[model samples]
Target: MFKLAGQLASDCIVLGDFQLCTLLLMNDAQYPWFILVPRREDATEIFQLSVADRSLLMEESCLLAEKLKDAFAADKMNIAALGNVVSQLHVHHVVRYRKDHAWPAPVWGKSPAVSYTPELLNERIGKLRAVLTNGFTFAESCP
Candidate 1:
C-alpha cells in the first residue's frame, strides 16, 4: 500500500529498501546526499509512526549518516527531515565539505542542482551500495 511520491521519484535514484523505509540518493552532484522515506501510507510526521517504526527510522538514519560521512570523508554531515515541499515522512542525509560551493550555507536554494551523467551516477550508486551492504542487508534488489 506504499507508493513513492512523484517528486521524490523524479528527483532521487532508488538505492534500495530496508525493513521500514526506502533508501534514495538525491540526484545532485554538488553533494553526496541520501534520503530515507518511511513506507507508511499517509504519514506526514515522525510521531505519526508506531513506536517501533520510529525507533527503526532513527537507527537507519544514524547508520546512513555514519557511513556516508566516512565514505565521502566529509567535513560535516547535514541531516534533516523538513517536509515543507514534499509532505512525506522522509529524512535527508547530506555530506558536506568546508570548501563546497555552498559551504557554510545550506545546500538548498543556494544554487541549482547539478545532475550526474549516467556513468557518474552509476559510480556513485555503486559506492553507496557497497557501503550500505557492508553493514545491513537490503530488502529490495540492489545493484
Candidate 2:
C-alpha cells in the first residue's frame, strides 16, 4: 500500500486531495496559494506519471485553484512546477491579483515566506483539515 508521506509545510492549510497528490496551502499569507505533491515514490518529473496520472494531476491542480478562488477570493491563479530548492516533485498553485504585493511579478524572491503565528497556525490548520478531511480521502493502492 502507498504510505502517505509527511507534509512539507504543515503550517499551510489542507486544501484537499489530488488522489496521487497531496494538496497543501502556504501559510505565509504572502499569497492565496496551494501546492500539490504527488504520492508517487521518487518521481522527479511530471512525465514520470503515467498518461492517466498526468491528466489527473492537471485536474487536481484545477480543483485546488478553484477552491482557493472560492475561499480566498483570489483574482488569478499561478501554477508552477519548479524544483529549485526542494527536489521532490511538487507543483505550486499561487492565486494572484493586480493589487497584490508582487503584482505582475513572480512570487519567488519578491518576498520571504511568512511564518504563521502559533495560534493562527493551529486555527488555520483546524479549519482546513476539517474541510479537506470532509471532502477528501486517501486510499492506499500501492507504495
Question: Which is the leading candidate under lDDT?
Answer: 1
Best by TM-score: 1
lDDT of 1 by residue, 1-143 (tens): 88999999999888777788898888898888889999999988999999999999998888888888877889999999999999998999999999999999999888999998888877777777668775455546444
Instruction: Extract clashing residue pairs from model 2.
Output: 2-142
User: Model 2, which residues run further than 4 Å from truth?
Assistant: 1-16, 118-135, 138-143
Model 1 reaches what TM-score against the true structure?
A: 0.92
Local distance difference test, each candidate: 0.87, 0.70
User: What local lDDT score does residue 3 receive in model 2, on the 0 to 100 scale?
Assistant: 35
Once fitted onto the true fold, the runs of candidate 1 whose alpha carbons sit more than 4 angstroms away are 134-143
Per-residue CA lDDT of candidate 2, range 55-119, in tens?
A: 98888777667766665567888889987766678898887888999999999889888876767
TM-score of each: 0.92, 0.74
User: Where does candidate 1 have its weakest 10-residue lDDT segment?
Assistant: 134-143
